[model samples]
Target: MNEPLCPAYSVLRLLSGKWKPAILYHLREGSLRFGDLRRSLPGVSQKMLTAQLRELEADGVVVRSVMACVPPRVDYALSSLGLALLPLLQQMDDFVQENREFFPSEEG
Candidate 1:
């Protein structure tokens, strides 16, 4: 079998965590504040969210902006590279929905 190239491997490494894809998906709608993202992802802990956001930012896929105000405000949005993944992610979502039988549910 042919080995995958380094660039593809790097992207996979960046997106390896369970929360990464969901975080990316949420960011698709537009910028979201830290608390907003946390609320959207019900089960994610604060630490995990922070870690994942940092990772995504480091990977150049997500942009983090901090606002100076009465209370500190942080927002996350997809970087250009990250926005490029939307169509692909949307296609994947459609595929999963269309092929639901192929992916068994845990409840079953």
Candidate 2:
């Protein structure tokens, strides 16, 4: 069946994962090793982080590079496609700050 397409849906779909947003935010700065990335996002299990990274890599949003060394270290960075999302994410951050009253914190 043919269905009407919504542009924003695609963007939303790409970022629907719980960890995707945070992952992108962290990668916005630059590349990070698996261990460092894991440390940045506390409470995230290794399995979950691996899965999320694979998804982002598959989506062409993240670039996974393996170093040719004794330990064979791997680093994850955002591709050009992922970089495009930075501005949008910043806008969302700004919106949240502007309307903080709409969102309540636990310590309210």
User: What TM-score would every model get versus the actual structure?
Assistant: 0.86, 0.91
Q: Considering every candidate listed, which one attains the maximal TM-score?
A: 2
In candidate 2, stretches whose alpha carbon ends up further than 4 angstroms from where it belongs are 1-5, 106-108
Q: What is the C-alpha local distance difference test score of each model?
A: 0.90, 0.93
In model 2, what is the error at residue 93, expressed in angstroms?
0.5
Which residue segments of model 1 deviate by more than 4 Å?
A: 1-7, 106-108
Instruction: Kindly provide the TM-score of model 1 when superposed on the true structure, using C-alpha atoms.
Output: 0.86
Best by lDDT: 2
lDDT (Cα, tens digit) per residue for candidate 2, span 1-108: 554397788888778887999999999999999999999999899999999999999999999999999889999999999999999999998998899999777464
1-108: candidate 1 lDDT, tens digit per residue: 667676668667867898998999999989999999999998999999999999999989999998999698888999998998788778878999999989888566
For residue 25, give model 1's deviation from the true position in Å.
1.2
